[model samples]
Target chain A: MNSTIARLTATGLLRGWRGLLLALLPFVMLALALLVRMAFGIDPEITSGLLDTFNLDTVVPLIALIVGTGAIATEIDDGAIVYLLTKPVARGRIIVTKLLVAITVTLLFAAVPTLIAAIVVTGAAGTVTWAYTVAATVSGIVYCAVFLLLGVLSRRAVIIGLMYVMLWEMLVTGLVDGARALSIQHWGQSIAAELAPDAITASLSLPVATTLAVLVTGMAAWFATQRLRSLTLAGDS
Target chain B: MTSIHIDRVSKWFGHVVAVNDVSMTIGPGITGLLGPNGAGKTTLLSMMAGFAAPSAGTVTLDGDPTWRNEQIYRHIGMVPEREAMYDFLTGAKFVLANAELHGLSDPGAAAKAAIDTVDMQAAADRPIATYSKGMRQRMKMAAALVHRPSVLLLDEPFNGMDPRQRMHLMELLRQMGSDGRTVLFSSHILEEVEQLASHIEVMVAGRHAASGDFRAIRRLMTDRPHRYLLRSDDDRRLAAALVSDDSVVSVEVDSEEEALHVQTSDFGRFTVRLPRLAADHGIRLYDVTPADESLESVFGYLVQS
Candidate 1:
C-alpha cells in the first residue's frame, strides 16, 4: 500500500477522457431515473427494476472493467510501468496499491452514483439504496481486481471484459439458467438479496457468494503481483 | 566503487536469442554498449537493470543477484528507451512522483535538484505531451536521477536530441562518471560512443564481439582485410607488380570486368605501394576504389572474426 503508487494510479485512471466517458454511465442512469419518475408517475416498483437491472447489474461491472484495466494496462502497453517498476518498492505492494486505487475509482464512479440513482428511483423503500450500494461495493472490488489481473494478462482486456459481461453474463446466462451460477452478476445479485430478498434473485447462498467473491478477487490480485514480478519490458525489436 | 557483473548471461525469447552467452563487468565510470540495430543492446541493458531475468547465469551488483531483487533498485537508476512516462502529468509532478516512489525523506528538494540537474526547471511545470523529443528525454533523465542511485543505465539516451542538448547531456554524464558513479549507456553510433565512452563493449548480431578501450576497438574495426578494385591500362602487368608486394595478399586479374581485384592484409602498406608499383610497371590507373566500407560490414567482420 504505497501512497505514491496509489496516487499515481488514481490520477492516471481519472484524468483521461476515457475516465470521463466511463464515469458518465451512472449519472446518465440517475438522470434517466429522475425522468422516469416524472414521466411514469413515481412508481417505486418500476424504479426498483431500473436500479436492479441497470445500475447494479450494468454499471458496477462495466465501470470496474474500464477503471480496473485502465489502472495498469495502459502503463503496460506503453511501457510506462517501467517508471514505477524500476523502484525498490515490493511488487506485491505495488499491485495491492494499484488494485486498491482501481477499486476506489470503480466505487466512486459506480457505487456512489448507483446510491444516488436508487434514492431518486426507489425513494429509500426497504433500504433499497443501501442494498444496491452494498451490491455495487462488493461487486466493484471483485470486478476491479479480476479485471486488473486481466489487464496484466492481455492487452485486449477491455474486449475480453466486455464479452464476458455481455455474452457470458447477459446472453449465455440469460439463455441457460444454470450458467447464472458462474456469473459475477449472480454474486452481486446474491449480495443484493440480503438487503432486499424480494428485489433480486440469488443463485447461491450469501455465505458462498461472499466467499467466492473474496477468494477470486484476492487470488486475482495475488496472481497479478506474481505476473508483474516476472514482467518483461520487451524492447522495440 | 559500484560494479555490475553479468556472468555468462543469455536471454532468449521464443526462438530468437537476443543476448548470447556473454559476460562482462561494468565498473564505476562511463562504459558504452555499442551495437547496430537489433544487436541486443536494449535486451542487455534490460537484464543489467533487473527488468528481465537472464535465461542462463546471472547479473549482479557487488555480490547480490539483480533478478527478483527489489533491493537492487536502491543502487541503480534506469532510463528506458521508450518515451512513455505518464504524459498527462507536469514534468515537476512526474519527477516528484518518482522521488516519492524512491521513499526520499525530502522528495521536493530531490525532485527540484533532479529537474535542475537535467536543466529542465524552466519547462518543469509544462505537461510532458507538449515537450519536444529532446525535452522529454531530459525529463526522463530527471525522473531516473531523482533517486540519485549509484549505477545509472540509459538505453539510447542521445536518440533524437539536438546538438546542444546532446552536448549538455554528454557533459552531465561525464561529470557523473568522474564522480565515480557507474554509468552505462547504449548507442549504435560509433562517433557517439567514441566521444563519450572511454570504454566500449561492442555487440554484433547479439554476440559480444569486442570489449576494452575504444582505441583498440577502433583498430580492430579498421584492421579488417581491405578489398580494392583497380582498372589499369595493363591489368596483368599491375597484378604481376602488386602480387610482388608483401602487403598484397592476393591479386586476381578479372578479364571479364577488365580490372584487378586485390585483397590486402596491410591496408596502409598497400595504399602506399599501389600507386608506386603501378607507376613502376608503367600501368596508368583508371580507377582505384576500396569496397565494403559500410559500418555494418565492419560489424559483420567483427562478428565473424
Candidate 2:
C-alpha cells in the first residue's frame, strides 16, 4: 500500500466539517456513557445491554459508514480521483491504501470511543471493555472495507450501506436465526460472547464468527480492488 | 517525443456513438481539437487519457495501450473539462498532492515549480473553493504540470478565462510546444485555435473533418461560399448591380425584410467590392452582416463539404 495515497486520504478526511462531525460522535458516545453511569448506577446488565445494542450494533456501523465511504466517495464525487487514477501505481494498491486510512479513522473515531464508553459504564470490568473494544474494532475494519468498496462501486453507497446495516443486519437478523448467522453484527457479537460472562447470550461459536469475519473482510477488499480497476469515469455528455 | 495514437477508435454509450471510428496521431507539437459542443471531443480525450475505454479499437501512448494502463500517465498529463476539483484543499496542497501521487521525490519543489509555471503562486495559499474561475483553471494547469509529463492534454482550457489570462496560457502552451512537448488543447473558438495551434484536428459530428497546418484549416474555413444579408437604401438596385459581377454567385431581393441575400464565391473580393460598388452606384449600404458566421454554421459547412 502506498503511504502517499494514505496521507492524501487522511488529510482530505480532516479538511472539512465532515472531520468535525467524525470528532463529535465519540464525545457524544462518552456523554451517553457518563449519563448512564450516573442515572443507572453502574449495573453490569445495563452496561452489557448498552454496549451490545447501542455501541456494537448501532454506533460502530454508523461511524464505519461515515469514515469508510467518506475516504473515497468525496474524492470520486469531486472528480479529484483523477490525480490518483492517472499514476503509475497499481489500482489495487490505491484501494488498499485508502481502505487502511478508512480503517484507521474508524478505529480512532468508533472503536476507541466504544472502549472508553465500556470502561466508563462498567467500572473495573476491563474484560468487558476489552471484549467490546475488540468486537467494535474488528467489525469496524470489515465494515469500512466493505463500505469503502461500495463507495467506489456505487454512487448511492451510503443508502445501500445503511440498508444493509439497519434492515439486513439489525431487523432481519434480530428476527431470523439463519439471517443472524449471516450478519456482521452477529459475527462481532459472537466474539464478544466469548469475553462476556455466561449471563450474555452465546450467539455463535467463536471459530465460525472469526473465520467469517476474515473471509468477509478479505473478499470485500479484493472485490473493491477489482471494482476500482474497472471504475469508469462517467463521460460529461 | 511522446505521441498519442488513436487508431480506429469508436466510443459508444449503448446505441449512441460518441466518437465514430476516429483515427489520428498527435505528435510533438501543439494540436487543437476543434469541434462544436457534443462533437465527441470529451469522449475522445477521455479515451486518450485512459479514463474510459474505447468501445472499439485502441488509444495508445507511444505503443502502450492506454486503456487500463496506469503506467501511461507517467508520460502524459491531463486537464479535464470538469470543474469539480478538490475544493477544500489549498492550491499549493492540491498541486503538492498531485506531485506526490506521481511519486516525485521532491514533491514540494515540483509543486512550487508547477505553481510558478502557471503564475499561480500568488493565490496558491488560498483554498481552491475561494479561487475565481481563471485562478482555478490555472491551478488545474499547475496540477497537470506538476509531474512534468511529455504529453499534455487540455480539454477546453480557455472556456472561462478573461482575455489577459487567455493570452498568458496561450503563450505558455506555445512555449511548451516549441520545447517539443506534445500539447493538445481543445477549443470551439476558431480564433483561439488560430492564434495558438500550429497544427489542428477538426472534428464535426463525431468524424475527423480535417487535419493539417492551421493555414490549411483556415483556408478550408474561409474558402466556403460566403453568404451575406445586406440591407441597403436601394436593395433592388444593389442586387441588380451585384448579380452582374462574376464574384457574386446569386443575389435575391427579399421585399418583406427589404434586404439583399447575396452569395459570393470569392470572400476576399466580395467583402471590399460590396461596399465600394454601393458607394459608386450612389446607394447607401446600411448593413452588411455575414449570415452564417456562428461556429455552428461554420462547422456545419465543414460537415456538409
What are the C-alpha RMSDs, in order, of all predicted structures? 2.0, 2.5
Put down candidate 1 lDDT per residue, A166-203, tens digits, no spaces.
Answer: 89987898899888777887887787788878776688
Residue lDDT tens for model 2, B1-305: 99999999888889898899899999999999999988888888888888888899989999999888889989999898778787878999889988988889999999999999999988999999999888899999999988999999999999989999999999999989999999999888889999999899988778888888999778878989989999988888888899888899999888998898999999999987887899889999899899998887788887777
Tell how far residue A164 is off in model 1, in angstroms: 1.4
Docking class of 1: medium
How would you encode candidate 1's per-residue C-alpha lDDT over B80-104 as one tens digit per residue?
8898988989999999999998999
Measured with C-alpha atoms, the lDDT of residue B277 in candidate 2 is 91
In model 2, the runs with Cα more than 4 Å from the true position are: A197-204, B231-242, B251-260, B276-287
lDDT of each: 0.88, 0.87
**Could you give the CAPRI-style class of model 2?**
medium
The numbered model that scores best in lDDT is 1
Scoring each candidate complex against the real one, what DockQ results?
A: 0.75, 0.62
